[model samples]
Target: MANPVELTILIEKIKAKTAVVGVIGLGYVGLPLAVEFCKAGFRCIGFDIDEKKVNLLKEGKSYIKHIDEARIKTSLPLFTPTSDFSRLTEADCIIICVPTPLGRHHEPDLSYVLNTTRTIAQYISKGKLVVLESTTYPGTTDEEMKPILEAGGSGGLRAGEDFYLAFSPEREDPNNKDFSTSTIPKVVGGLTPQCLLAAQTLYDYIVVRTIPVSSTKVAEATKLLENIYRAVNIALVNELKVLFDKMGIDIWEVIEAAKTKPFGYQPFYPGPGLGGHCIPIDPFYLEWKAREYEVSTKFINLAGEVNTSMPQYVIQKTIDALSENGKSIKGAKVLILGMSYKKDLDDTRESPSLKLFDILQKKGAVVDYNDPYLPEMPKTRKYSFKKTSVALTAENLSSYDCVLISTDHSAYDPVFIASNSRLVVDTRNLIKDSHKYKGKIIKA
Candidate 1:
């Protein structure tokens, strides 16, 4: 097959580092990827609907924690952050990195993806490459987006010919010192062979490597599989955590000992619950898609059930810890440590801590939280705490009836927390040397 003129032009521009790249949704995934593209010598136009984020980036400031302002300042010459959608025509390549959250019923919510596509279609022209980096169910690029773009204002322009289309799932691990957007291997899939090549060539300039798959669905499924693998493993450990608690065995210690064998075992830690954008939600995308094919994803559904049940388990542990301390959960003064999903990062999407907070408040416990990373609770899709982090002082720590350690951020001093608190519920296994603080600690 002859390469489309769009593909040939895009490839030439990409190699020459002159391609004007446009990235939509400048959040965790988009911001880092756009910065990498700028560092790779491409002039990138970063698009976001949030005026505050756009304005901050325009002034070389970063809203995301791990992405330093110095990096944004350095990329300012080549990176332009804006809320303008009409400027889409100025770019030779566009990448969509919007959030693919689940709806109320756990169905795949592609409003962000589809709305961005519709905006791109308005300004889309010939000889441009379009790629979707949002994590979604298989066939989204081909089935949902392609038709929208084809029937868009471009006068029924053909995909893979008029404009290249592809799916390259984002692999963003925030606060992981080991990996960044540029270091991670990107998986690219396209609607056609030319679409694949164009997308792969573009990512090759910024990323370490590009793994090209047969089709867009394969690429989408590849991402789901990566997260689902983690989801299932974590669910296994979560289920074991409940059982091991009854058996008087420490799941963390068991994992540490089991991981010594190295060959047959990989360790997945149990937390309060699943947090972050990918693992907690990505599996459901596949599960929801499986329903259309009249297939039952029993294992995946079971994993979801186990993972979702973890927050309640954490609550039960809290209740038990309080009861042991000669108090009831009702009217007990409780303080939650760490508001963000994971330790040391401010990204709180799907964080189980929110669920825990709502449950505790509903259960009539006086709840407050402290996270060094998050000062005030921001409004989320399903939660609105309207509270700021209390100072982690010795007096403040001693005041709470029960102190629950949800995120084991490195900033937290285990000894200090144990010495001050009346009772503690340790979820992340944050405290070590249990003999010294035996009376205060309860591992959830």
Candidate 2:
């Protein structure tokens, strides 16, 4: 049981907006969260190992595409961006929002999360609240984090007794115009009942709603379930897309028609493949953990296979479309549109667009890319491109043998692209209903 006196003091600080909230890993998730805490009247300190991100935040310059520079500038008064871990001592509440990426073998590589936890443990004190917002397996909080934290803290500082610990998964949808961090309902679970209450009170100041669950493991599982649901459904649709293509049925049209039902149907569109930080990677964490229980995650494994194969599927469609025009891929001039995973954002982690780009180039096709978000291709772990974004103009569009729409950004004018391009391989169905470019389009 937690000391009632200590819990009360922490709750009081959160209610009065006087808590110093320390947020770690200032990326897509952490940056917005830190901003929300500051906006909610709490003094926030953001920590990141990356010096460039810290400098940018300190200067009120936004590196992320969706996070506005003006918003960062306005929040600078209440938000302190730093790389120093020693400043953790000033915080009443600390939130870890680091990356939980997969390893080379598709296993959960928790190095980032674990390292962040170790640092927090070194400076953690009694009466302080610690929360993890990183996505991972169920056992991560209780099995991995709790032990490390307990060992690092002072003898008197006990979880749920002297101090508090919780897991609150981050639900950050980058570039989503409708729901900001404050509006998204937060899910929090703790090592104990008192830990849960303290975390709930802290989030109540920022988010519109706070859902308290049984334990930290449940909270971790909740995040995995949310992402796995997306991965499985996306795979289902991607598989359907292949079958529908052979039957000459437009999967996009079928989806629009199917979505009219007022019950039990949520539409998940088919894309080049799974992308982003969560959908492409989070499911695998559960899959790896399931092996410990001597069970198989068939759906997850199958989804991985089907979704992973989509880039190749799109490539084949491109080759077929080119062959129809009496052109071989060996000498074809191909232009890839959209480098980022989704539209209106600049994040490209696990983006299938890169895979498509690599495949196209390897097959002897001359490949170029144009993304308003990314002017030049950044070096990735598996692939590196010495290419700059091509100018999207009438002459430029007409110069390509095939224009492949990998990401359906809102900035693209479907009619203009279809009218200008010699052949369009639209994997995203961006130009699906356009009557003007119907003749030049091939729905991949």
Best by TM-score: 1
Give the alpha carbon lDDT tens digit for every residue of 1-444 in model 1.
434565777788999998999999999999999999999999999999999999998899989999999999999999999999999989999999999999999999999999999998898888888999999999999999999898876486888878889999999999899999989999999999999989999999888899999999999999999999999999999999999989998898999999999598888999999999999999999999998999999999999999999999999989988898899999999999998899999978999999999999999999999999999999999998899999999999999999999999999999999999989899999887655886689988
Model 2, residue 79: distance off in Å is 0.7
Against the hidden true structure, what lDDT does model 1 obtain?
0.93
> What are the lDDT figures for the candidates, one per model?
0.93, 0.92
The CA lDDT at 362 in model 1 is 98
lDDT of 2 at 12: 92
TM-score per candidate, chains pooled: 0.98, 0.97
lDDT of 2 by residue, 70-128 (tens): 98998999999999999999999999998888888999999998998899999888889
CA displacement after TM-score superposition, residue 148 of candidate 2 (Å): 0.9
Candidate 1: Cα lDDT at 422: 89
Candidate 2, after superposition: displacement of residue 5 in Å?
2.9
Q: Which pairs, if any, clash in model 2?
A: none
